[model samples]
Target: MELEFAQQFVRPILDKISSTPSSSELIIQDFAVIMIVASIMALISYKLKQPMIMAFIIAGMIIGPNTPPFSLITHVEILHVFAEIGIILLLFVIGMEFPIEKLKNVGKKATFIAVAEASGTFMAGFAVTQAMGFTFFDSLFVSLAISVTSTVIIMKVLEELGMIKDEATYLIVGIAVIEDIIIISLLAVLQSVASTGDLTINEVGMSIILVIAFIVGVIVLGSKIVPRCVDLVGKTNHSELLIIAVLGVAFGLSFIAFKLDISVATGAFFAGVLVAESKMRIATKIIATPIRDMFGALFFISVGALMDIKQLPLFIIPAVILIIVSFSAKFITVWAASRAQRLGKTTSLKTGIGLSSSGGELALVAAKGGADVGATSSFVLPMVGAMTIISTFISPYLIKYGWKLASRLESKGTGSSDTK
Candidate 1:
């Protein structure tokens, strides 16, 4: 029935439009519609106390090609350009938040926990999927998708809870930074493997070397170059020129990374970090936030737009299974890692729940890479999206109640000790 409907109405229109390119006015109209819908959804999300990112995804679903009544977007390619810009800006802002000196203060314990939890999460994901009879490649994608926590969402929620000053929060943030570096490198390797269908040990080794070299080069060169450039620009005291210079550095490094066949996120992020060293970082972030938010909205919406509701049901069971397994695995792994670091039981629980709360932006980022390389199924985004939504809802509550639960236990233990 749907096929017939598409044949009668959708196909003919698509054919006509494909032959005759859409006018600039039509493209503008399409984008205007997207923004209008997104704005409405954003308001609803605000009222509902949900993440604006979730609202953007919902907006995409309503207008995306995969949903019913055909796609509202005639120019997906153009929208993609906006989405890519959003990603670049998002990473750049993330980088600006972490200066190299700040990273140096992340103790060895945090580093150990980060590695332990990440590796454990990956193994749990891979093992469970394989046990369920998924293909090796499918399992790999699923594992990668589930292994990392969402640093952006977690920090926002922690800030809201006023718990950002806690030791657990610092550990979580430190772990996330490590995860970002590893995951970005992994994405590069996975993309290579996906394209060629084979990756030798030498190739993998070389890729790791290149990744390390790139990061080191960025740190060394960026540290020296960015500060001087910012100082020169700052002498003018011109806000517009400063903004241009900041964005120029951001996009310039991103462009260089792309030309060198690395993840643009890595470049943009390191660029931000380098810029972070300047006395002008706070101002740069202030100027960049509005632009970042706008583009960031479009990027997440693009993720939602790609989701095919019709295809979702087919993958629903697998998605649910993955959600359960991934969530439990992350919680357990993080809890154990925290304990090994000599944190209290309650703190461990909180860390586990905090880390488990949302797959974070990294899940979707990984899903996008999986899809690009054909390393995973088309349902990867929807799967990660569903898990992200569930985790987002549960995370804050866990942070709140988990703390209460932990405190109660601690008090109880103290009372018993006194009685003894």
Candidate 2:
């Protein structure tokens, strides 16, 4: 009897020990490490007068799997999930600030500029990649990936430079909004082409139609319904409830967009627009800002983590070429388009510089799509990732100096006119 009791007790103890979950512990440890590294890098970036996003990315690189000595994150997948949430929240806050009425003001000009820049960049990227001996699909994917500028990077740079209130800022943001819509539609078409090796006219038409319907339905119906719902929640006078309700709407729309094969970022943005229509807009923004900042940092960090530094050297030359081609194409296109719209030389120049930096979340999406369908070369994703990191790193500097250049040009033009 004594021996039986001892065996039973020991068996129970072993079962308990084996059943203890370690994944959760690892996840917690990863988050702690990410925050510590990110904080240190952010402080360093601030001291160097660089964008905090750049610092976060650098921190991610240091602790990421690419850096063997400091690869502290054991659960990269979980970090990606947090990064995605960061994107949704970042776009959501932006949407709240830019409402339907504001969009209407810049709609036509923004659309024209966005289309021109996207087309020009696509052509330039395609030609360059093809000349470098990339396969047809690889060239196509790279071209498409480089065409769209990073909205997140642009917004963050503008905010950091205290240029958020500039007249050119409005136009720049409007163009970004239009580009988001265009890129989402193009991404769908590209995916279809990749999977089937061909794209049908019907597929193209249907994709466009779905995009239009989603935008219209959300704006028209959401404006009417969402505001009232928020108002009802606001009447409750519970700040927590108000925040919860708004977040629910944001996540709900994002989920719906996912189901409809649309980008979740788009849905999150529209959710913000709808919320902006409510009386509680200010309160909603105040509550959402912290959430956005936290997740936004994670998003950029994840971008850096995705970089395989070992593979970068192999693709460095082509990546550099791509960056030059895409940046030059975007700058020229946006500048010419802005001038054509009579936005003034200073505004035009600033707009051009602001939009010059390429590669972003959508570029990554395009790269991943290519990889998933096995239609792109092995170099495609890594090359795009490299471009993203480099472009993002330089975007803040471009904005800061670009403003000075615009001012100088304006002064010179004024002097010439006065002399005349």
Best by the lDDT measure = 2
Candidate 1 lDDT over 165-201, as tens digits, reads 8767877888887777677767666665565566688
TM-score of each: 0.89, 0.83
RMSD of each: 7.3, 4.4
Q: Candidate 2 lDDT, tens digit per residue, 85-187?
A: 8867977887897778877776788999999999889889989988999998899889989988887777887787787988888888889877866775566
Error of 1 at 327 (Å): 1.9
lDDT on C-alpha atoms for all candidate structures: 0.79, 0.81
Give the Cα error of residue 304 in candidate 1, in Å.
0.7
Model 1 RMSD in angstroms: 7.3
**Model 2: per-residue Cα lDDT at residue 171:** 84
lDDT of 1 at 345: 72
- Flag clash pairs in model 2: none
Clashing pairs in 1: 150-360
Candidate 2 regions with alpha-carbon error over 4 angstroms: 1-21, 134-141, 150-170, 188-198, 342-347, 359-381, 414-420
